[model samples]
Target: MSPLLRSPLAGSGPDLCYPLLLNTSCRLSLGPRFSASLLYILTFSLALLTVLLNLLLIVSISHFRQLHTPTNMVLLSLAGSDLLIGLVVMPLGAQYYISSCWFLGPWLCSAFYMLSYVLTSASVASILLISLDRYLAVCQPLRYASEVTMGRVQLAVGLCWSCAVVYNGGLLGVNMRGPPRRTSCQGECVVVVDGSSDWLDFLVTFLAPISTVVALYLQVFAAALSQARKMRSSWAAAAVGAAAAARRSELKAARRLGVVVVVFLLCYFPSLGFMGEDVSVNSAASFWSTFLLHLNSCLNPLLYALFYPWFRWTIRLIVTLQILKPNSSRATVLH
Candidate 1:
């Protein structure tokens, strides 16, 4: 029996999850049942929305020949990671949030934590790749086409996912051994990485990538401003307007993607705060931080729909099943 299971008032108030195994089973969550149910419903709905939106992005990018650019490939990779988070991580998180127990056993718990870490790290890596892509497109226009090939982008995305898996394995390898090492009680599934490991993971997965994004975006903005000024002053009156329009479009895309990166950083930074110490996954603060991180998946596609007219257009086609039509992949999305 664990200390949590040995509470003096444990069985006196509510029913144990497993009445027969009183000493080992978790106590039912203490709260108004209706409120808990409502929360669960909302969480599950958000998870579903996240999945659907990211799925739309995945399909739109993957199916459209026009969207087969390196930049779109990065977005595709991002949508894939977000899809996994929504489909797998969020549902499992909801179960823990609602039931407040680990009924699924130790191996499943280890696998859940491992998957969560991999997807999250992959998301961060994908954002970094997006920022780099935009930086080159906006700041290094002359070399962008030559440097950022589809093959290179695909290789980078593959490496990002592979590194995520390898990095998390190194960080959480001990915890993945079995229940005896990770869980203090039978009914609880807790992942406890040491403070050192937590800090290292934070630095590698969160801090370093975020810093790179910020730096890259700053350079991008500066270059865009300079380019706008040059276009205004240097080009002939007839050509200036058209050239400026094209440049402005590129700048706008960078700005929109910048918003996505900023939102990602905002949602992700809170989790870093909780990772400083040996944090329990079941803590209230941990739960909220994790919720915010998962909420990023929901917000990402919404950001695309809001900023990218093409996303809205493609979404309409997708929802209406127009994408199933012949040669729909050849449909022009961007004008």
Candidate 2:
């Protein structure tokens, strides 16, 4: 067998990641060759899937003018972040997982972690904003149009991304300054925030947003239920029926978005548990938790495809290249 094709674990002389840099290289600690290869394939495939699916969402929402509603504007922002996670963050993560070392050097490592933090915070903030949007639409139906205008939603989306950058930048400033503070040995790229900072991150990014989502969704569902009951008992008038249909449509939208939010939380929650502990990046617990969180990006568009008719129609249009024609952006996607 060729030397290059030989198993990484076979005939190992400590299995240095960079054989040339004996003093500075990291030692490989992976398992069997087949298992490692399988893991690499799985992670890379997931990363690719995340990128493609979220890209479809971005194109569908951005190209179609009929989809340029206040709520879809928020979704567009979310797709942007998810696409970045797939494009930038997941590939780096897969590299780390396969090599079990950080050969990218300290500066790039810091930049990578900073970008990851910002994107994650942005995603969480987007979910929060979505919850708020649904709450207002379902609970304050009369005022929703005036309050959650497209311009206002656009501003809110901008604020979400901006705050994520500023907040996580401040939170992770210490690690970003000078040399990387987390690594103890060469070829190691770990992010170790202090206990206080971890707790603070947990509170601000996870706890607070989760609390708000739960509370708001509860109110939204309650209001929707009451409104539904009212509609069912109302007179059989034409105006009333039209209003009831609109309300039903809004209720369905809220339910679909609620599933997305819940799945996002479920995928993200495990990472919080792992964060409280001192697990290494290469550990099984860490890999699974991180993988689950990243998998949420892939799951989101699938949910939209399942529950959202507009999304299905848009996907069909996008897939067939029908959207390439002139004035296609103005095409009606929603029934």
Candidate 3:
């Protein structure tokens, strides 16, 4: 018997397949729950859409040689991490969310949980790396090529995955295996940290990453400001206008990265805050709070679709050609 199973909030996990709404506090059974049904639909749709978008991104990135660079290699790693969460973790989560209990065996349950944690952590780290890359390119253009070489980028990616595995794995040890727990049906389910480790989890997982990202961007912004000041001093010079324009573009790129940082915090922080509150931590809010976290899996694809112009254009080109392609009727018409 696990700690969660013995807790007062034992029925807190959203029952995905059972289709019954029982208030964790009141035990008032609401007839035929729709929340689980909605969650199921949302989880399935988001995961499927992400898979398609990531696959298209992979193919497009592969086919276009010009898109192959150290920076893109980091992007590719981020896409890969998103794809892992969408494909591997989302299905299990959807099943658990819908069923209300983890039907998957203990090994698989642990594996899925671990996989989601690792991939998500890696995704955050990768975003941090991307910010650093953009910073170097804009702030230190002359040395950027030599500094952010392919070998160094690959090492950074390797470090990202390694850190993700170790850090999140530690949490998995605490959450999944640390305490024994059972589901509403009295079977082995995931261990829920009702109150303990909540702040620690928030700091290590979300706050630390966010702080690092912000710090990197701050350095980038400062560097850009310095360049702008230099350009202003040389305003009468022939190349000053070009230099200013280039600096402005770099600032714009930094702003784009700032958007990424903002989105990540927005999508993740609510859940952290919800978990932070004692009352909410053990309520339906805890179960429903994960929806925001799950939304993180779907964000990368949307971000790329919206921000990466080349990727968008490539997708459009492929769609247009596919739509315009003639079927068997074209052969008959020619004859």
Among all windows of 10 consecutive residues in model 3, the one with the lowest summed lDDT is 1-10
Which residues of candidate 3, in runs, are more than 4 Å off?
1-35, 174-188, 193-201, 224-237, 241-246, 274-283, 317-335
TM-score of 2: 0.92
What lDDT does each candidate get?
Answer: 0.79, 0.78, 0.64
TM-score list, all predictions? 0.91, 0.92, 0.76
Which ranges in model 2 have alpha carbons more than 4 Å from their true place? 1-13, 234-239
**Error in Å for residue 117 of model 2:** 1.0
Backbone clash count, each prediction separately: 0, 0, 8
Give lDDT for model 1: 0.79
Cα lDDT of model 1 by residue, 127-246, tens digit: 999999999888777788798999999999999999999888877895445553645446666666766777777789877888898999999999887876776665453567775676
Q: Which has the better lDDT: candidate 2, or candidate 3?
A: 2
